[model samples]
Target chain A: MATETTQVNVLTAEDVLKNWQGHRRVTRRTIEAFPEDKLFQFSVGGMRPFSEMAWEFIRMAVPIVDGVTTGKWEEYKGSKPETKSELLRLWDVQTAALDEKFWKIPPHRFSEVDKAFGQWEMPGQATIQYAIDNEIHHRGQGYVYLRALGIAPPHFWERD
Target chain B: MATETTQVNVLTAEDVLKNWQGHRRVTRRTIEAFPEDKLFQFSVGGMRPFSEMAWEFIRMAVPIVDGVTTGKWEEYKGSKPETKSELLRLWDVQTAALDEKFWKIPPHRFSEVDKAFGQWEMPGQATIQYAIDNEIHHRGQGYVYLRALGIAPPHFWERD
Candidate 1:
């Protein structure tokens, strides 16, 4: 187990925000790199239509972070928007929030217990990390689809 | 730019440790989640080979924290192993070092710029988060390959 100390540190928060935004930019580029025809149609088992995955990305972040700060799922914003541009706009807002709110997190909150997905109970920070990991997991699949569709995505290592 | 605090917060260290371990577990699971044949064979064009990407996950972490504590890339020890298990053994060692060495970093040192990656310079913490994010980005691809190979991966929201 890790130890807890007296003061707060926001460096990880800042770095997380930077990495998160970089992810958003590259992922958005992945989406735009695909053809409209394949974006909605390509899937391995007809699982997670690319269009739905894109929309889900918008809904995923706010609710997870809201749960972190507020400790209630109902505090999450309303439903995701239907259009792609609207989804992108919503994503931009939350990504910016991650940066702005980085320093606002209270110390020792990493160990704060929280409920997730209506059942899973774990640390608040774990929940947040899981959410981020989940999105990246799906986006990776989207990368595969893009490649199969003959589109070249941004390089794996390039952050900007 | 983020402000520097001389205060040492234990929770931030805990979170960093958690993130470090989580990254290790998830990357391992991502590889385990793939069938052996698919693990090394799959990738989008111009994407790093899957095995190479896995090594990159281990390669990226050491120097960040090394730079933070030692302030020099000369202290970085990223010896590439010839086989997979050897690579994992090295990964386990470095991750433990991250848990041990990085926690010793005073809060004031977080803002210290570390030319950790040789070409890229960032706050010591950004180096750590970049490693995490980069691993997640590639692991996301691992999940896609899992699905395509007729293997069902655990839900990302669920921790095992």
Candidate 2:
């Protein structure tokens, strides 16, 4: 059978930038919904704690993005804060930087490959994409934890 | 500051069944790796083409489940087809039945809802969570479509 590959239209750097920005907005809102007490909760003994997952969310982004652009696991020199509020503040700052800087990415750069987590070889675009998608994935777990604790997270229906 | 009021989770019974079934390994294998022509090519626009939105694997399951449980829709009531030659034929049949059955779901029964879809009046779960997460959700879309097209998807790196 002749296969039809659905090519995602080549989006402008600006469009991709907007998409990342939109993801950030939703992420921040999700952060705002969390109560402090449950920050470290993990649904199972084996899974990453929510607090740890939140930190993982932070650690994963810069190195992943750096890997894509630089093609190596660059030393991530950013300071890790001690509290969730500080983490959230740093998150907002870094994501804002992404929104502002992501548009400057050249279109020809999509094929650039980089090492993620200092181990895996992945595309630069994949790193950034993982940054966005990973949050949605884990934030999902956050919802499960929230429900278990009787704290409702934001509704998925309404958009900011 | 206007605190964002928590939102409700509104999903039809149809949404629930499709989501659960869509995540099945057999279903994932069938939908994600179908021929691109068959997988990406579909009859709708604005809506994801079947091949592209492998994430929508849940579409067929939701409506069929809803119809069977609620007795409200007629979309899934046709005589079952007997033979299957191509990769997507079974996938198509199941999805179509579910879609038809979705229309049959009664409005009043939405309160009872599916475990996966949750309820329509609470801020407890996200529609996208129920819509995407409970089903194939994140890793399912292009990944499975690629598989359906005979390209192997990336292995779960964390999995041993």
Candidate 3:
């Protein structure tokens, strides 16, 4: 005879939001560290400039959040901002939108699956995490670009 | 009056694991792109070498996984590997350890809070995502380092 058991989790819904925001804050700082000229012009190891990567973030994130909030998948092609400030402004819009709408999704919603933007049939949480993950990865490239130009990047661990 | 409604998500536990592994594969490839001499010596903007960042990943990941499986928190301070091969070998060790133990954790365990390494009192899942996020962020740095050195890094999106 064999006995079976199930383990329950202790993580609360609030933790996810806090964790995501911490990383988000640090990522924004990374963006601010980039000089205006370098944001669009810099590339290291044949990688795209930070601007292109930022555009990718905008392209994927806004729609994902909108889809999650409204359950309507809308595909988007970003209006690539030519200036770094415009890029930041766009980023701010998305950030505010998430803050307003992310909670509209109940905690359990994170664990559910969805085909975001007509692609990536993954859990709701996975798509959101992917958005954060994408930004962090690209910021790493931005840090490198700044360093190559002899500019110091914001410390990696900071959330502000 | 506005009616409150709960949103349903489409993601699942299996998707989380798959997504985590996909990012892990690409990050490992990023490590392989580093040249030996530059692995420890290269830095842009006063950042630690990519090897050191890789060491941070190894230090954090092995313990977090071990803690999840064994229910014991152990802190580690990595003795920096002098060579890239040694670093990769240690990384493989941790990867194997993760494969063996990660599934031992039932899905609910992800939502449980654990003070990883006796610090970072976060949900087990958040800690794991942090590990993945950390690697992706630093790998971006590795890509930049490679490009600055005139080396072509592995494609950013490839997991294979």
Candidate 4:
């Protein structure tokens, strides 16, 4: 008797993208929950304001995709948005860009190692995972900030 | 002309375990950085003390592993530790248990969808990802609490 072995892909490229976007949706809700004044000025225990952290997410996200796909690493030259509305506008634009550019990645490239932005060296997919992880980490800080401000954050589990 | 294609496994079960353990290492250092008095009693913006949040991580992590592997869900029945030392002791023990039990999972099981704790329904691997994401989330809150107490947290990226 002979036996055959087969391999299964645990996560597909589309699945990874959807997971990242689900997290983005929850984070967008976190931004919406913030009071306008506190979005840029609030800090607890000396952490930066939530707006600054959100800017960090924006800086790394789509640009990372561009780097992974095109091997073109462009430093973010955009000015920071001073108000909540402007911030949301940029966020929406980048969200669309992420959806569009992410598909351009060849599926085989996900497992290929690359030095993202000539800095962190990891699998292309891991770099993308880092972006998602970083957002969740900061959003947790935003939740703390929201509670301190006496506002409830968007539910952590309700990523959709 | 003929063409052949192959599937690539982007992340293995061992890789997932290592990633989770790396995050746990960073979270452990965070627990070590807290002032002993503030671990259980400190709060910012009305969040729970860092120790309470740590307990939430402990309650969910290894038990989720057991539930996934054995299809037997056990509610955490242990009493909360009163001091940081006791807390770390339990953390270390559970950390060891996680390594041992994670291997018991059949590889195909990673993609099998089940309702974790009879509540959240997703692939077994995703349930594990949620555990890691939740820890990162709470640790961000811990970082805020530490800063408010005039303490510095461990570097966020140095998981090792």
CA lDDT of each candidate?
0.64, 0.47, 0.71, 0.84
**Whole-model alpha-carbon lDDT for candidate 1:** 0.64
Interface RMSD of 3: 5.8
- What CA root-mean-square deviation does each model show from the true structure? 4.6, 14.3, 4.3, 3.8
Candidate 4's residue-wise lDDT over B35-96, tens digit each?
Answer: 88989888887778989988999999988888777777788888999998999999999899
DockQ, 0 to 1 scale, candidate 3: 0.36
lDDT by residue (tens digit), candidate 2, B2-88 = 111111121223333333343444344545444555554532212244443333433535543453345333333343322223335
lDDT of 2 by residue, A57-89 (tens): 777766655455445566657776666688788
Tens-digit lDDT string for candidate 1 (B18-128): 666776776766666655555666655455556777877766676666666677664335666655566567767876776677666666666667677477687776666
Residue-pair clashes per prediction, in order, are 1, 19, 14, 2
> What TM-score results for chain B when candidate 4 is compared with the true chain B?
0.92
How would you encode candidate 3's per-residue C-alpha lDDT over B43-67 as one tens digit per residue? 7767788888888888888787767
**Per-residue lDDT for A33-133 in model 4, tens only?**
99999999998877899999999999999998888777777877789999999999999999999888887776667778888888888888788888888
Interface RMSD of each: 6.1, 17.8, 5.8, 6.3
Looking at model 4, residue B115 earns an lDDT score of 89
Deviating ranges (above 4 Å) for candidate 3: A1-17, A68-72, A103-121, B1-17, B68-72, B77-80, B103-115
Q: What is the Å distance of residue B105 in model 2 from its true position?
A: 29
Q: Residue A125's C-alpha lDDT in candidate 1?
A: 64
Worst 10 residues of 3 chain B by lDDT: B1-10
Each model's TM-score, in the order given?
A: 0.76, 0.52, 0.78, 0.92
Model 2 off-target regions past 4 Å?
Answer: A1-5, A8-12, A157-159, B1-57, B60-160
Q: Model 1: how far is B29 from its true place, Å?
A: 2.6
For residues A22-82, write the lDDT of model 3, one tens digit per residue: 7767767767888888888877666788888878877877677777666688877667799
The local lDDT score (0 to 100) that residue A110 gets in candidate 3 is: 69
> How do the residues A8-87 of candidate 1 rate in per-residue lDDT, one tens digit apiece?
36444445555556777777777677666566667753467676787777676666666665666754455755555665
